[model samples]
Target: MGAEQNWIPTEIGPADVGAEATPYGLIDHLQRLEDLTGLLTREKALVFRGFGVTPGELDKVFDLLLPNRLAYVHGNSPRTKVGQNLYTSTEYPQEFTISMHNEMSYAHQWPARLAFYCEVAAETGGATPVVDGVRWLAALDPEVREAFAGGVRYLQNLHDGYGFGKSWQQTFETDSREEVEAFLAGTEATWEWKKDGGLRVAQLRPATTRHPVTGTEVWFNQADQWHPAGLGDETAATLASIMPVEDLPQSVTLADGSPIPAEWVEQIRDRGLDEAVNVDWRPGDVLLIDNVLVGHGRRPFTGSRRVLVAMSD
Candidate 1:
């Protein structure tokens, strides 16, 4: 199915951005958009003018801005940075249309919501893209879909062996091997370690999860299960050595315990990349995206494309 053909009508208030004494004050004024969207239920996108508000004052609003308050918001400023580091991480800021995938899919824990704000529009490309995760979930194969419904069984390598960033241990507040081991011990999963000491083996989570809002189950495994320690680094390497990462025993049906084919799982990725909607950004444009219902990404780019992110509880 395509995007709901019926456009959810939205009323736009005055673009006049009033001065806010506190960051929350800006939210009070911004609340109108929240109310109009039924907490943003009506439409997936919105743009704000800032009513000629000063950039300095806007900074104050940013201080008060909460991830739950807005999924994404773009300011009028021409300069902003989206990711912390793009080059060493393979995470591009403004390159091409990003594949439609949920943020932090590799992490056992994920944010419920995501937001993007456009500070300035690029002269050429640079557009925010999105896909309806629910729509994709509904179209998945019955057998394969059932497997994902079983829940996601995944492991993330705490080490940045792939060169994404510092080791996962460094990124966390506490990265002690003992602490990590303790966290792994708390889960019910099968695991093993890699030949090298770089990664650990783990299987501490379910194979799929039920969406609290829509009650729909989607393929939660994106890229976490294929890592070295995520699926028993040795097991993953062995599987990768012999078979493609997609063909591994990543998902199983809860009802019959049947396995989901790798090809079927890839289809979900194909749908996300093919059916996603692109959001071309402009300066002073504020956009909110439903992380639970939507998946997003952007292609690599040349110039500086800055965007800020905040998570919703």
Candidate 2:
């Protein structure tokens, strides 16, 4: 498996780095940062292995990787903040697999880089499967690609402070309606307030984007995560039974106000996973990537696993 995903990073042990995996070692590497920066931009991902970094030294290591960290505002996934800016990876049950997505690709702005640090490794599975955006785009059926050519429409139904799905406060990281409204004004989106104290948001975003420096076209979007069809029939049916489609926590369709066929969504979900390169993790390992150039997902795992993630623009 490792040989097949040769694009994935290989372990860079302490001996290979010629220093212990400590704050000082990180600082020393930064002195010759230009070469590393060029390599990261070209490769899109890297992993620092066997660097026995502790929780207290995470800040120092992260500062080297992400100079100006950004808050996960407007994110839809379930996560818990365990430190100042660091957060636990998606909080889904261990039995389920998390599909691939570029960080905040659905938003008008997104993180340019991200770092994932493993504090504990799972006894089984729990690999971070990644894919080259170029490869993923190639693996898709031509018909599915053409269907999403125009773009996608994303709809989010956020509660005032109760009920299913994340509250508006958690999604926008604010309790004040004024702040939420202010933030939405800056994006290419519109919204309406529901009588039931829910906020219904609608936005049209591109299904693909080009990398800034490399100018590489990548299949970039979160339609799979937003669309009910991507979930199994049983789960999608349950959500539809409970509420109107528009009232669901999240939904998506084509940009021209037409339905996206379930088959299209299923192919997008399946092809991405089929072509992904899974990177099995070890404790104390840190995976860094150029967010737009790569898509990442979580595989099902057993036993305890703690992967802390943070991002920067």
Candidate 3:
């Protein structure tokens, strides 16, 4: 692809629009801009830099960037809710790199837009890498793509109060079993309450999806993230030694209950990362992305990195 077409995220700075390097100036520019959604769709991702927006001023910024911010319900990543419909971006270890995937692609429904704000930049090596989903799909091997043609099944085993992953209450953000059942009633999912006070939920989703506006087909599954083969050999082996595959915190398989090969899993993970463009963090910087068009992940870092995220449909 040409350079213009391959640019995953288009960056904007105060100087680019002749605005002051302040939050109010950024807000004024955003208010005056026409068709913000259309611009986001065309660019896939946008980085708002040199704004000097503080934590106290983030809500106002988010209100414009993410209209009708949604709660992080049914999320698998570890995060802390810090404000109304706002969360700390994945609390995964600082030493481990997260693989690229469209947010919540395995679910029946997902956010259409995501906004991230960097409150504190890491000391070294922490960058949010974004990949064009179209490029990611094109990078995958034909055999691997065909293997997922029929769709994939995602399995989650959430405990009542304590477990390897999240608890059922935490996953659904509710303490009521009736509420959880009500939510699941609307999805194409099956759930079973285990004798050990755990909940096993399974969902089947397509491997690829077309953008609602552009109609561009993109890779849109979390098979690599959910599969044991993508976890690194040491971690996978430790999990295997602890429990059987079925009882693992999370797992995935083909729609027909067939195994996805390890090589395919590795390819999916590697190719997406290989095609990604890293967005290095700076305190007060903000990023807005069309979640369907771009997949995001994190690189290993040192020191403290505090990035907050919010989403909207």
Candidate 4:
């Protein structure tokens, strides 16, 4: 995490590959690469800049980068689906920074790779910050890491059709209760239906995971994002004033259901952001990352910004 060891995404420009700065030329360059996946595993992240890739031409590029794109099922972020299995990056407010976390790391299964396309760059800020999971883990205090070694328990309270946060239908991207149950049946999660037409789900997941290819263990949980302490003090206080802790939209605790200290979550949130390297966006730039090896977040911004994301297993 030090300056000397800071890792940034490898940038591949048109000139780097000896190609024209156009979609067709970029496609040709990618087609000639023999081991794209292996290259990604070693680099952790690759940023394609100065290619002038347009929305109309994104399909071909995405097909080469993220084959077999996945739907954002069970995703917690608020995003608009704009194309086949493609979504606008989290619709969080532009004035507040989004802390780093691996996408869906709290779930039983998560994507192996993530691709982000910047369609409209913000006038200021709005850089996507990514952190190496290994460095992130190293940056945490030993006590904090030890506390999470027992794993973490995540709870979600999704309303039937209206309430705080997302509803079950929107969360699972389905209207059928039976289908939702069927999906949950395949995972080690437990759920209950509330009298108020809401659903409560509880899941126990490891705090860290190993990269399938490299066998590198890294910090891989969303405890900070889910914990009230991770929300700024003002937000956490406001939510506490309105409802009981258990009634919050989401909560996290130790796997044995023990409360995690507020200071620990604060440290977790701050350290990840501290160790991150930002990827500034430019219109038509695409970034691909090995999801398990890196965690990503968004910085607060001014002016309009539009970034699309897609994932593949």
In order, candidate lDDTs are 0.46, 0.85, 0.92, 0.93
Clash count, predicted structure 3: 0
Clashing pairs in 4: none
Residue ranges of candidate 4 with Cα displaced over 4 Å = 1-4
Please give the distance, in angstroms, between residue 48's alpha carbon in candidate 4 and its true position after superposition: 0.2
- TM-score of each predicted structure versus truth: 0.62, 0.94, 0.98, 0.98
Per-residue lDDT tens digits of candidate 2, residues 1-313? 2222456554555677686676567556655467765777878888887776667778888888887888888999999988767889999999988888999888889999889998899999999998888777877888888888999999999998888999888999888889999999999889988898778889899998999998988889989888887887999999889998777898888889788888888888888898788889987778898898889999999999999999998
* lDDT score, candidate 1, position 108: 49
lDDT by residue for model 1 over 119-152, one digit each (tens)? Answer: 5456676666666665556656677665555455
Cα RMSD for predicted model 1: 7.8
Q: Name the lDDT value of residue 218 in candidate 1.
A: 46
Report the Cα lDDT for candidate 3. 0.92
Candidate 4, 150-261: lDDT as tens digits: 9999999999998999999999999998998998898899999899988999999999999999898889999999999998899999999999878888999999999999
Candidate 3 on 25-130: residue-level lDDT in tens?
A: 8999898888999999989999999999999889989999988899888999999999989999999999999999999999899999999999999999999999
Q: Per-candidate RMSD vs. true structure?
A: 7.8, 2.4, 1.1, 1.3
Candidates sorted by lDDT, descending order?
4, 3, 2, 1
